[model samples]
Target: MRLYEFEGKQLLEKAGVPIPKGFYVTYSAMGAVGADPELERIFDELGGREVAVKAQVLAGKRGKAGGIHFADSPEALQQVVEAMVGSELLGETVTGVLIEEKASFEEEYYMSLTYDTVARQPVLAISREGGVDVETFAREHPDKLVLRRFGPIVGLMPWVARDAAAEAGFRGRELRQIAAIAVKLWRVLVDNDARLVEINPLVRTADGLLLALDAAILLDGDARVRHPETNFPPRQATGRPLTERELIAQAIDEGDYRGVAGKYVELDGDIGMLTSGGGGSITLMDAVAAFGGRPANYTEYGGNPPAEKVYRLTKVVATKPGLHGLLIAGGIANNTRVDVTFEGIARALEEIRPEYPIVIRRAGPGEEEGLRLMRELAQRLGLDMEVYGADLPMTESARIIVEKAAAYRQKVEGK
Candidate 1:
């Protein structure tokens, strides 16, 4: 949920923070030759010195990825834009570029606000060593990093901001100015329900002007309702764009549900798992680990996912080369048909039919019928599937799968 530089700068300007002038253009238009005729007008009006042509992407580490460049002349600007316009960024093709006036930075400073899940509040971070990555700076030069936690109820206060600036070695008027800006940014975060608002290289010019050289903003998806202007249009995995189904699921942030690609989350011990429901999937993983077995993934079918989606999910889970066994588990179901989950697993197993052992522990509503249906389906498909009754403790079922898989692997490997 990282906003592009243009978007970040727009938000910062509205918050009364100083920012450089910039213009954004998508690559859909023709190349430099076609674009120059129109861009010349702006170049003439703005007596700006250096301009930056930055590639817009959701991913970070853009500098490392060569997504940013500087242009000293108008011709150089056109060359940089032409070279960067249609290029792919880490496999996602560049759709647009942000052209901005570069700042004559004499000194760089860093400031940011991030949510602390454990503290259940926001943490304000600032450093004197600014232009570089904050994490690296904090690690190598820990003394320069100053962090203060704000209470969730009170948000950030002016006094706390002053203290943070003082710790970062700022003095007198400069300290007050930077700290006041920080307080304002924090206020923006609280009002806008932002997960993070960061300004790296908040620069001070030789002429004594403070400005933001770059900004990063991450909006809280849960609080998107509060910010109507920030909604992202739906898109697909190949980044071509998303269909209706992808959009529906993308609304929720789930570690269990990945993009179009297969999702696998490693557990402590050694049991490959496929299950549905976020709460139940996590509990199953914990239970498996608690009993000395590992759940290979945190994957779920999501809300009433269709057969094809389940089949697609299982195909991903069952085919993993590292998996020792499989534990298909779920909680008491009210609306989700047990038969659909069972069928998805059965079909996926039938397709791969790896020698790995599998134990299915499913129940609740349509229990008797679903169990019978899966049993018949497995036998007809010439599959060796272990179906456990609902009464069986989930912990016991996971242990059984682990032991069976171990024995099977050992027998096959002659170990």
Candidate 2:
């Protein structure tokens, strides 16, 4: 979950990080900001000072895109807001603007607490130079950027934070101030289970106070169950609106921690897939494509998920209107009960009575019973299907499905 600037600011404020005071001007206030009494009254509360009108879009690099506009007074602010409210920025329509008091800062610095994959731990990064992309700045001026890795359990302590700030060239009161803010950022990360909490351009105002001018946050999608107050809309990994099947697949394992049956990404193709295992899913996708089977979606369910989860996932995958075949395949499971999992899948097929050819290639504990269950389902339904165990390699399973699906399509089309 990547929060909008206003939402990130809310979290920062709650954690005691000084941020430019701002209010969200929703698109509903686009033409009404200056003329409408209510909207105009809100602007008056900014004390008629210089303000920054920022487009509220998930797209990045707002500064270069004319998404951030400046105004010295209320009339100017209204005009800026009017121009921004409905404009398109980086392919995303601006839905609103975050109006904030523009800070009079002499120097800009960068700071963020981000999850580092290599370290397998969250690391706090700070820089003397700010207001630009941190990665670019670090590359250009590595000496100015400082990084400190912190243990997830111990967190960023006060002493280490102050030292890190000093290392970034801050001294005296400035060092103390930035160090305190750093700890607060760590709190924001841990408390929210966020993978990233960034304040790019941590500015030093003319008054010598530090205020965060911008924010970027990304929460762990898997940890979303722990935060109930959030209502962020579901967005595909590619930032597009999710399809109906994608949404259904996404919600399958919401509250259940038993196993994952909900990792799904919809694709443009005809073959439906229900695969399991971690990296195995990607390998299977590649195998299927290599064999000319266009997987309609990439989905995996494993770790011994309950039958209902698999059953739900099965329905979501198999019922796609244009599927020529359905492939239920995975590596030999280590702990996942194939018999139990297959029961759910078989039950779903019984209900769907799909005309498309189906393939089940799975092997693990209870593999015998599981293969038997699928074979029985095929016989009872008189379905076009093939059931296999570990005797056939996963790649071979993919080839079989592609061959069957292609043949079935030809027969149906009289080609």
Candidate 3:
């Protein structure tokens, strides 16, 4: 789960990390003139200082996309807010804006605490050069990027932070300040069950103080059950709204906990995809797009979902309009029963009776039986379906579906 900027800053403040004084203004608050005396009062309280007007969205790179603005006075602040409140940035509606005091900084730095899967422990990364172009800086100056790994049980220690900061070239009081901020950031990450806690341009002010100029935090969704009090907001798509079919699929996924049957994201495309194995789904999506096939949606089901769950999900995908083809594929399964998945998909196909094109590529414990059942069902329904096993590469299946769907669409349009 991703935290909005304000929410992440709130958590950072709670954990003792310093942040600029700021408040949030929701879109509803920006009504007709004089509708919000409260906003006027907030501006008045700021006393005409330069402020940063930042759009509150889940995705990153907002700075480069004109989502962040500067206002030197109350009137400028109002204008900036008005311009950003209702507009869309990176396909996410700007529901609110963060009004913060702009700081005069002597230098900027980068810091982050995240779990390292390769090391199987938590890691802290810091760099003296930081900003919107931190990626480029890291790529060009890899030695400047300092990383320290800590045992998950022992956690981040103050001495370790100080050492890492010193290694990253911090000196004098700034070293202690950066180390303290790092310690607090680690606390925020652990206390909130976060997968990543990042602060870019952790600025050193002219007054010799350190403050977080920006924050980005991602919590571990799987660990949500442990922290029921934490309220993470819903995430929006990168480019568009969720379709009705996608919403139905979401409800079905949350209805039961039999297996992992969630993360259904809709896209603008004609090919409907039902895939399993998280990594495999990503690979197939890329292949489909690489071969000039537009994938309508991305669905991943694995860990042996129940047949009923598969049936509901498949039905949702099958009912999606403008689909020229359907691809049901996955990696060779270890625990998932191929026959059970085939039965559920067959049930959905029987109901929808799509005549365009269908491709199935699955191989697992019940491979032979599942293939036979699916082939028989396709023949009986007179469906244009082709079934493949482990012998065929997943990318090959993607190409076949794309070609078939294109041919089918041309024929139907001609008719």
Compared with the true structure, what per-residue lDDT tens digits does model 2 show for residues 1-415?
7888998888899899999877898877565523556445656777777777889877678889889988886667777777788777877777788988777899998899998899988888989888887777788889889998878888899998988898989999999999999999998998888999999989999999999999998888899998887667664435455678878888898988899898888888888888889877888899999987899999988899999999999989888887888888999899999999999999999999999888888899999999999998899989999998998898788888888889888888885
lDDT of 3 at 210: 90
Q: Residue-wise lDDT of candidate 1 within 49-115, one digit each (tens)?
A: 7787789876666778899998877777778877887788876677888887776778999999988
The TM-score values for the models, in the order shown, are 0.74, 0.82, 0.88
* Clash pairs, model 2 backbone: 108-130
Best candidate per lDDT, number? 3
lDDT head-to-head 2 vs 3, winner: 3
Question: Residue-wise lDDT of candidate 3 within 1-415, one digit each (tens)?
Answer: 8888999999999998889988899988777684356656676666657788899988889999999998886767778899899899988888899998777898989999998899899999999988857678778888999999998888899999999999999999889999999999989998999999999989989988898999999988888889878767577545556767777788876757877766688887999999988999999999999999999999899888887888888888777888899999988988899998778878888899997799999899898988998899899999999999999987789999999999998998888
**Candidate 3 lDDT (Cα, 0 to 1):** 0.87
- Ranking, lDDT, top scorer first: 3, 2, 1
**lDDT values for all models:** 0.74, 0.86, 0.87
Ten residues in sequence with the least summed lDDT for candidate 1: 258-267
Candidate ranking (TM-score, best to worst): 3, 2, 1
**Lowest lDDT 10-residue stretch of candidate 3:** 34-43
